[model samples]
Target: MTVHNYKLTVTWSGNRGTGTSGYRDYERSHVISADGKPSIPGSSDPAFRGDATRWNPEELLLASASACHKLWYLHLCADAGIVVTAYEDHAQGTMNGDRFERIVLRPRVTIAAGDRALAMRLHHQAHAQCYIAKSVNFPIDCEPSIE
Candidate 1:
């Protein structure tokens, strides 16, 4: 078996002079960074008093799943001689209170040339091999369309 380790730093930057003095005293803002990579501004969901402009944890989770599946799908397509010209996913995640209920990944793919049926089937393989999707407890659904 092979093992891969990842590390990153998350620093809170929401102290408004007085530290966590009260529930709404501090901003729900922070920075996520790793070596040789650009920092990502992070915050809680806007409903939880987070900055609407920054990337929230919920959104990041959804993005991770989408990106992981996309990478896997692209690799599978390449190996199968499927020429993908464009790919986009409009993914959505539903949260019940504090827990995520499910995530729906709607991927629209444009292929220059390939077997349409095989292209669609690759989504299943991609989802099965997605590390993020496998790690998450909630269900991840893939709704793929080939063009």
Candidate 2:
């Protein structure tokens, strides 16, 4: 058996005290170099009790799913000799049932200068083979387009 390793570091400082007294900022300005992805939120500010700049771990649950799927899609495209000049995903998710159970990711994909059928084929391959979609418990769907 083998296991992969991952690590994360978080730092923050502000008016120390958990109350409606001052401000607390949780900004994620730095990221790991190996993947070149911003793993944390860039700006964090706690102006009130209901509004906080620090990212709640729960929010990432959905973002991770989308990001994972996007990366997988890109890799699959490359392997199939598909050139994706531009790609973007506007993912949205909802939480309910006290369990944060519903997560929906809609990825709008764009492939540059390729046959429509070929692009469609690659998109299909990307979804069928995404590892995160296989590993997580969520209803994942996509609308891949080329423009």
For candidate 2, write residues 16-49 as lDDT tens digits.
4553253333222322223555655422223223
- lDDT score at residue 125, model 2, on the 0-100 scale: 68
lDDT of 1 by residue, 1-147 (tens): 799999999999999999999999999999999999999999999999999999999999999999999999999999999999999999999999899999999999999988999999999999999999989899999999999
How many Å off is the CA of 64 in candidate 2? 1.2
Error of 2 at 104 (Å): 2.7
- Reference-based TM-score of each model: 0.98, 0.64
> Whole-model lDDT, candidate 1?
0.98
